[model samples]
Target: MLTTLLYSPQDNSLIQGDDSHIAQWQQSDDAILWLNIDGELTEPLQAMLKQTFNLHQLALQDASRDRHPPKIEDFGDHTFILLRGLSADSESINCDNILLAMFISERFIITRHSARSLSIERTMAALHAGDISLATGTGALSLKISRFVVKRYHKILFDLETRLEQLESVMLTTADDKVLAEVVLYKTDLTRLRRNFHYHVELFNNLRDEPSLPFDSALAHEINDVCEHQHRAASLADLFYQVASDLIDGYISISAHRLNNIMKVLTIITAIFVPLTFIAGIYGMNFEYIPELKNPYGYFIVWGVMLCITAVLIWLFRRRKWI
Candidate 1:
């Protein structure tokens, strides 16, 4: 789907419409043409974008596939940027890669996205809320949007750290695979976030040097701080994996010890019964040669012998500390 929003600086009016009717918004000095695209865009729409905005063919191709890494590029005529957005839910974490093509000139600003992202939308909201104003130009809006990306990276790290602590507590009492699964997921989420955040950090750092798109001096300081945050988050993720590996080793050692104890008990019981069963089997053999069949006290004598053997076996096992 393609929808347009025209922000008119004249009356602080917002206009919503399709392609043809949005041009009337050009009358305002602070007018912006915002195009939001969701899901799979059709061929005609792609062609329209290419013809209307003169988007590079290669950049359009990159937008079609979702795994593109986050970065920004200035093509002299327009700027092409790819960013990662949080695609999390109550169940599992997912990452959404969005392509934002910004066409900035003296008269207007046009932002095109291949998919919807909360990060982008929130920046738009901030722009509405006066965090960014039209007098500051499109450069201010771009910096605010990148700042949102940096903020979300911190959130991902915070959440991962919390889950790891919970997993560590679970490991102390019970050996479980669920905690491991959670660790695996958290690791993956952090890795994705770190890589994406790093790319943008580099992008912004490079932008800081370019005088044409001079970012606010205050935000320039934030670029370095955001880079440091990404580094810390990535380091913590590696530490979690190391801790998880050690826990797994401890669980295996415990399992082996329990098995050994069980085996020792079984061995002692089997040894005690073997001789007794042999004696009973011999006395019960075919009657032709059996003298116990004639003796009246024979049954009691055999019972006494079996009891003595059982007591001796138990005593031996206890003395050897095999129980």
Candidate 2:
């Protein structure tokens, strides 16, 4: 769907409209037009962007395709920026990041996204509530949106930090396969979040240096701030991954230690019984010349011998602290 918000600087008021009024507002010389498209761009919407906004066909294709990395393309008259906003819910580790495509110039701004974006929603709400004044130029508005996207990354980073903490806490007291699996998952998701921001860090730096658009010092500073935050988020992700990797190694080490202890106990028991088994095998020999078999207390004698050997082995093991 298409949502339009027109900001007239004279009255400092926003005029909201639908697709029907897009053409009328697209040509307005006095107002700054904001066109937002949610979901895949249909033919008509594509045609509108092409004819009205003069958006490049290549940029449109990139916006519609999957797995387009965050980037900025300088189209001379207008700049096309592609950004990915991370989702905060760690539970949905497999969910894809939200893709946002923006076209900005002095006169208008167009934002397109494939999926629902909380940051975009918040930006739009702020604009509609008149919380953001039109005086902050289109570049600052773009920066505001980028900042919101970075804020989402911060939320995911916080979640990652919390998850690693929980894993570390439980790792010592309760190490298990489930906990290890969770650590691995956290690392994977953290890595994904880092990768998303890594691209933005570069993209924003290049955007700030774009020669075609004269970015004000304030706007440039905000872009730099966004880049710094992205770098921070990426660094946090790496740290979390390392912690999680350590947790996995620790869990494995503990498991191996327990298994070794169990095996050691079993070996000690077998060692204690080996000598007794040897004596019993001798007594069971069917030789007619066996003198012990002829004795009346031979069975008792064998039992006494076996008990003595078992006691001696147990005592020896205890002395050596092996049991």
Candidate 3:
């Protein structure tokens, strides 16, 4: 869908317009126009962008690409910005990042995104409600939208931290394979989150050097705020990933130590039975000339010997603290 909100700085009035008179509206310099294009960039839409906004071909091409990280391109007449907005999936571990493309010029701002965004909706609602307190200049509007996107990141980071804490709690109660799998899954998510926010840091830094936007000082300050936010989010992600990894390792080490103790106990039991088994085997051997076969008390003597051997083994094991 294509949505447009035009704000006249002179009268402080806001009005929504259709695509039919967009080109005519662009001819006016008295108002700041915000054109938001959502969904795929069809050929006709691309043509409209070219004819109405005079956007460069390369910039349009970059915007149309299916996948691109956050970046900025200075096209002399205007500047194009590509940003990532995170959308968390509560039902599952996997999350998504929506790509937002924007063009900022002297009198107009164009925003394009493949998916619905909270920032866009909020800004539109504010504009429709005639909230002119926000500066309608292209630079300020872009900064506002960027700030909203960063706010979303803050929520995602908080969720990540909460998940890690919960996982750690569960891990302490049970050190099992299922818990380990969850730890690894959360680690993967943290890694991806860090990568996504890292790219935003670079994009915001580039925005700071942007020469096309108006009000350099204000724009730079806003960009710096975004940079700081991205840095904080990325750092949190890194810390969470490391914590998850350490938890997994600790659980595995505990499991290994438990198994080793079990094996040691079994080994001690087998050692105590070896000599007893040998004595039984000798008495059971079929030999006609065996001297014990002619003796009446041979059975009692062998029984006493076997008992002694068992008692000696037990005493030795106890003394050595191997039981």
Candidate 4:
């Protein structure tokens, strides 16, 4: 679907859809125009965007793809940028990439994105509510997008931290392999996201405070907030990775210790029984000359000796604390 919100200076009125609406918005001086393209563009839609904006071929390709992490391109007439907005619980949320392009002219401004993410949606609503106090022109749109993206990141960051903590708690208590595997799974997901966000760190820092980026003073503040959000997310992801590593190490160490203990007990039992087995074998031999075989009472003596030997071995084992 195609959606457009136009703030026209001619009548100080809001116009809101497609090519004709955009053309009307474009004619108005000192107005902000937002174009939201929700899905894959059909041939006609592509043709419209191409003819209307003269978008670079590479920019269109990047927009067509699932998501472009974060990058800025200089297209001479305009600067095209792809900003990645992360969703909560990627296991449940789609990793949809949002492309926000800027057409900065002296009087009119235009922004475009492939999807209506929380970032753009929230901004559109604010702008529609006629709360000029929020922001104005392209600068205001940039501010809203930045604020919304960062705010979403904050919520997701909380979730990420919670998952990390819960996994650590489970590892400390039960140390179940399944729980560990889950931790590894989430950690790996975070790893991929971290790489993506790391790219944003560079891209946003470069984007931030770019006086030439058409951000007004108020919008610059919003950009700063965005930078802070990216910083916090990156830091939390790094910490989560470290925590998962520690958990794996702890699990392995405890398992190894338990195995060692079992082996030690078994070895001590075997050592204690070796001599008794030898003594019993020697007497069991069918020899007519054996001393214990001739005497009727020899049986009791042999039994007593065996009992005494077993008791002594048990005592020694207890003394050594090897049992």
Candidate 5:
């Protein structure tokens, strides 16, 4: 789907249309154009991007792909940026689910994404509500959209931290297979998020240090703020990954300790029964006649002997603190 929003600062009017309005928007000098493309890049849409916007072929190719790492490239007249956006329906921290490709220039900004992007939706909503004024400049507009994109990570990271705390608490008493599985899943998710956030940190840092277009002081400040946000997000992801690792190690240690306690109890029981089993074995042998069979009190004597032996073993084990 293709959607266009043209905002004219002079008249404070907004025009919402499709691809057909592109020509008219291009003719106006006092308007800021925001073109959003969702889903696959069909041949006709690709042609229009090349002919109408004059986007670089290489940049278009990268945008057309299903997956690409976050990056920024300065093309003399415009800047091409590939950013990973969180999918609206994503349940985990998988950054590959949505890729947003942007071409930003002085007059217009174009965004392409393979999936429904919450960041794009939020920005569009803000634009329609008059909360965001593109009259500032397309550079500021791009930064606004980027800011929305980065905001999506905040809730996800907070939820992840909450889950880690819960799991840690649960692990204190029990480390079952299910709990272990969850820990593993979280670890994997955090790893992916860490890598994604790391790329974003680098991308924004590059944009801040060496911008493709000249940004005024305000825009430059905004870029710096976004870079700091990216850096903070990356650090949190790394920290969470480490926490997940520690959880796994703790689970292993707890499991081992439980098994050792079980084995120790079994060993103590076996030790206490060994002598009794030996005495019983001796009497059970049907030789011409065991001497004990000739006496009536032999059975009671055997019982007393076995009980005494058990008591001694128990006392010895307790004295050694082995039970």
Candidate 6:
């Protein structure tokens, strides 16, 4: 689907239309157009992008890909940026990512994504609600959308931190396989997030340090702010990954300690029973020359001896605090 929003600041009017309005929007020099392409990029849409925006063929190819790392490129006339955004229908922890490919120039910004994007939706809402003014130029509007994307990472990181804390508490009270599995999953997810955020950090840093077009100092500051946010998101992801690792390690240590205690108890029981078993073995011998077996009170004596032995072993264990 193609949705276009054209804002003409001179007349102070907003026009919402489809692909047909592109030619009309392009005729006005002061009009700022935002073209949003959702889902797969069809041939006609691709053709429109190539013809209308004069986007590079390579950039269009990268934009059409299902998976691409977050990056920024300068094509002299326009800036091409590929960012990772969260899918609208997924949870924060186990959410899927959608690529938000943008071709931004002075007067227009084109965004393409394979799936619905929360960041794009929020930005469009802001534009419609008059919270974000298109008169600010496409660069600032793109930054606003990038900021929204970074905010999603912040939310995910917060959820991850909360879940890790809960897992820590659960580890203390119980040793469940499910919790371990979940921690591993979180670790894996955080690893991926950290890598992606790292790329985003680089992308924003590059955009800030060397922009495609010479932006004013105010726009440069906004880029710096977004870069800092990306850094924080990446750092948080790395930290949470370590937390997940520690939880797994702690769980293993707890399980080992429990196993060791059980083994120690079994060892102690065996130590106490070994000698008793020896005496019983000797008394059960069928040799006719056994003198103790001839005694009338032999069975009672054996019982008393066994009880005394048991008492001694119990006292010894108590003194050593092995229990």
Which model, 1 or 2, shows the larger TM-score?
2
In Å, residue 117's CA in model 4 sits off its true spot by: 2.1
Superposed by TM-score, candidate 6 places the C-alpha of residue 323 at a distance from the truth, in angstroms, of 2.3
lDDT string, candidate 5, 1-323, tens digits: 89998888889888889877788887888677889999898777788788887888889989999888988998888899899878888655544458999899888899999988888888888888989878878888788888878778877887888999999999989868899998898889888888789899999888888877635566888899888888888888898899999999999999999999999999988988899999999998879978888899999999999999999999998999987
Worst 10 residues of 1 by lDDT: 87-96
Ten residues in sequence with the least summed lDDT for candidate 2? 86-95
lDDT of 1 by residue, 240-297 (tens): 5566566666656766777788888788878988999999899878879787778999
What are the TM-scores, per candidate, against the unseen true structure? 0.66, 0.87, 0.87, 0.82, 0.92, 0.95
In candidate 3, which residue pairs clash?
none
In model 4, the clashing pairs are none
| Tens-digit lDDT track of model 3 for 203-278 | 7776766555553675666677777877887787788879988988888887887888899888877886788789
In every candidate, how many clashes are there? 0, 0, 0, 0, 0, 0
- Candidate 3 local distance difference test against the native: 0.78
lDDT of 6 by residue, 144-204 (tens): 9999998988987898788889889999889899999999999888888888999999998
Off by over 4 Å in 6: none
Choose 5 or 6, whichever is better by TM-score.
Answer: 6
Candidate 4 lDDT over residue span 145-248, tens digit each: 76677567556657767876787677666748898787677667667767867876786687674644455465567667778887877887777778777877
| Candidate 3 wrong stretches, greater than 4 Å | 88-93, 129-136, 209-212, 289-323
Compared with the true structure, all predictions reach lDDT values of 0.63, 0.79, 0.78, 0.66, 0.85, 0.89
The TM-score of predicted model 2 comes to: 0.87
Index of the highest-TM-score prediction: 6
Task: Indicate whether candidate 3 or candidate 6 has the larger TM-score.
Answer: 6
lDDT of 3 at 108: 81
lDDT of 4 at 286: 88
